[model samples]
Target: MRLSELSVGDHGVISDITGLPPEQRKRLVALGLLPNTPVQLIRRAPLGDPIQIRLRGGDLAIQKRIANCVEVCLK
Candidate 1:
């Protein structure tokens, strides 16, 4: 499933990141979102513009449109 489809408190391992340019992929990796990393869904913005995820000892918020491109497997 895509990262955007995960619910609050859910945890998953990233399987792939597609449809993004190299720079974008590198940015995500720098944020500790590399493939195979486990992440947790924390919450979503009230307006749903972005979703908060817990990773790498911190929380990071990502736009839903971008989240949709990240495929993950439940952990």
Candidate 2:
């Protein structure tokens, strides 16, 4: 499922990042978001716009639209 569809506390491994913009895809990759990498839904904003995720020893915040581009296999 799309990363955006995962609820807080869910864990998964990234599967596809081809749906993101070229620049964004590169940036995410640099931060260890490559395919098969493990990820966890940390939290969400009060309005649920941006979602927080933990991966590769750190956390990153992703917007709703961008999150839709991240495909993951839930664990």
Candidate 3:
């Protein structure tokens, strides 16, 4: 499943992020969102343009388009 599909409070492990460009992938990795990393859905903006997630003990907000490219295994 994609990160964008996860609901608030849901947790998952990233499986792949090949759908994103190199720069985007690097940015995500810098935020500790690499493949195999655990991620928790925190919340989303009212319009859903950006979604908040917890990783590496902090919150990271990503756009919906980027979230769609992150494949994950739900927990």
**TM-score of predicted structure 2:** 0.92
Clashes of each: 0, 0, 0
Q: Estimate, for each residue in 1-75, the C-alpha lDDT of model 1 and write its tens digit.
A: 999999999999999999999999899988888888999999999998699999878999999999999999999
- Sort every candidate by lDDT, greatest first: 1, 3, 2
Candidates in order, TM-scores: namely 0.94, 0.92, 0.93
Which predicted model would earn the best lDDT?
1
lDDT value, candidate 3, whole model = 0.91
lDDT of each: 0.93, 0.90, 0.91
Q: Which residue pairs collide in model 2, if any?
A: none
Model 3 ranges with Cα > 4 A deviation: none
Q: Give me the displacement of residue 57 in model 1, in angstroms.
A: 1.0
Per residue, candidate 3 scores C-alpha lDDT tens digits across 7-74 of 99999999988678899899888878888889999999999879999988898899999999999999
Report residue 54 deviation for candidate 1 (angstroms). 0.3
Minimum summed lDDT over a 10-residue window in model 2 is located at 16-25
Candidate number with the higher TM-score (1 or 2): 1
* Regions more than 4 Å wrong, model 1: none
Indicate the residue-level lDDT of 27 in model 2. 87
